[model samples]
Target: METLETLSDKLDTTGDIQSIVRTMKALSAVSIRQYEQAADAVASYAKTIDMGLTAILHDRRAGGLSLPHTGSTDADVAGLIVIGSDRGLCGRYNETVARAAVDCINDRTAVLGVIGARAAARLEAQRHKADRLFLLPGSVAGMTPMVGRVIVEIESWMRERGVETVNVVHNRREGRSRAVPTSSAVLPIASEDLQQLADARWPGPGLPFFRMDRDRLLSWLVRERLFVLLYRALAEALASEHATRLAAMQSAERNIKERREDLTSDYRRKRQETITREMLDVISGFEAVSGSDD
Candidate 1:
């Protein structure tokens, strides 16, 4: 049985919480839009890179030049990159990605790299240690440098550590507000995919020609391809994070509204009871006074 004052205090506290939740919801919505736009922009750039790679490969095949092998077939070491969120309040966004990374390990000797603090903590809780930890970019503008750093790390792993295969695990935006955890192999550009690109009809009337060395051109195209893939992953992961947060905040807002309604009802009922008790006391006193006078 709480007093009226206590009930009033609870109502006020709930109102403040509701305001905060609404603010968070608005911020999340804005962030999701920006990140989704970034993802779209990067996707267009990726298509351009793919076209360039296709032209180079087509020319080489026509000239009887051997296609350079992009990925190693007989390597023992593996590299794993896990992208997640640094902040919480996103309903297991970080934990889900960490779990996916763990499942992707598959008993291989892996050099693991983590991109978010919260995600790294989750992985550590599962008795897994990361070889390197990279901070997640706070905004779309900051992602380029972050991706560059990741590329350097990947190169180091392959060049210095003899890592042959590289894989990335993250949550990708599925629909308007849903995220699905997925894993993609980043290294060893799949031969089948390359062949498909090379075999496709050229979009233009004439095939473009380049004077640069074929192998050098292929290497450059491959690097750009990696950058495009990494950038797109980061953008999608960030968008998914904001979508999850928006959903969580919406749920919190609903709960807070219900609680506030219940508290208001209780306050009104108690106040009415108090008023009735006071009225009864006044009436009884008047009756006693009249009897005394008589």
Candidate 2:
């Protein structure tokens, strides 16, 4: 009621800001749950495949697969896959990944395949051409198929372009930018890289002994293993994005709460001061009138 001109403005501004923070928090929560689910699925699949791969290698007897060329090979022509968020408000999620990707490609003359538009923009800003720009779906579930497809495409690219080295540029769930982790992939059907694939596991108890042509089985196992790896990397990247967004939203909400509380306190104090000053003025005026009368 006191003529504190800014009181209404403060409430309006703080209310709007608080609502924005709340919305962000809710969106982040949804994303976190989604990422967690995807991560679980991919992790389980990878574990099973790893077991299978190990078994197959063990059965090979003569070191699984042989290395064709000598140990030494030409330096890698890297293929960078940088994953980032499609939506903003997750503080620095895209920026950090972009920075890491840029740093990686700069180190080696390589082709970059940017996974998100924001990341692509960052790459362009650095005056780098992303060999490919792939779009991510709104949901992580939509990502599995895309990742599988990407692996197939990347395989072809690496083979045709003679790119032996490939790595994933992605953020970690722990909110740390791991910079650039360069990974050499199984390419050119290298005896070395094929050997790198863990051997397939023995069928579980109660499962009838599966008979198959060993060579065909090996081929199937190799391709499936590659797809599994690609899926895992993509899932992990997606999980990190969701986790980062959740953390950022929570921080923003906390800041908004603090700001609102401060504003409320300020408004109340100013109102109280105005009331006190009016009372004082009224009392002094009465005293002055009485003194004039006397």
Candidate 3:
């Protein structure tokens, strides 16, 4: 029979442990959907803008206008953006990004725009100055307006700071800590990346003789392409973030389970020891009475 004391201790441990695991589970569930919505919005731009960019490239070459590449990278004043989790349960999610940020642009002069509080904290710990740190609202819808605002802010920051390049650091994973610390340039766009976009098959076959005013179409195409590139970056970082969170939660859940089992086993052992001692005491007491009567 398990003693009340032992059982109580086991209950306390289980309750405390379960609470943490439950919180982690809820966090994972919430983060997953947020990533999905953000991803969908960002990914859609790839489809909408890629074809138009291709047309622009083809026409530009035929004419003599050299459209500036959106994918090319350069180092002058650098802009670094890191996206990490606001809540922790996902071990190493914030650390991985933070370290990568440190490795790449941890310099004091580099301007930082951090997306999560945890990441911002880490950067601050390392004494990195953050010009802007963003904590995304819960839902992707909340993030929509933020997208443009952030872009504008980053643009303004880069110009004011004389930043020539922008790099983003985030965890990339579908699940597990398999997250790769990724760095993507956000400034002076890479021409090669843009050229790849130019190659994507867009709907409406290239008209054998496409009819349109070249200048108007070209300007519109450039704007759309820029939007697409920025959107893609945000989407990819978010997907990676979700995967990291889920993996961390799952791992935490497992650890709690193991710890609970160990504590329960210990409690049971202690309870049995107490019960056996009580039985021996009773027997000894009866024997002593019998001896006295004799």
Top of the candidates by lDDT: 1
C-alpha lDDT values of all predictions: 0.88, 0.66, 0.69
RMSD of each candidate? 2.0, 4.9, 4.2
CA lDDT, candidate 1, residue 34: 95
**Model 2 lDDT tens row, 26-47:** 7766776676677677677766
Off by over 4 Å in 1: 284-294
User: 30, model 2: CA deviation in Å?
Assistant: 3.9
TM-score of each: 0.92, 0.73, 0.76
Stretches of candidate 3 above 4 Å error? 1-7, 26-30, 33-41, 56-64, 68-72, 106-110, 162-164, 193-227, 291-294
Weakest ten-residue segment in model 2 by summed lDDT: 175-184
For all candidates, what are the clash counts?
0, 12, 8
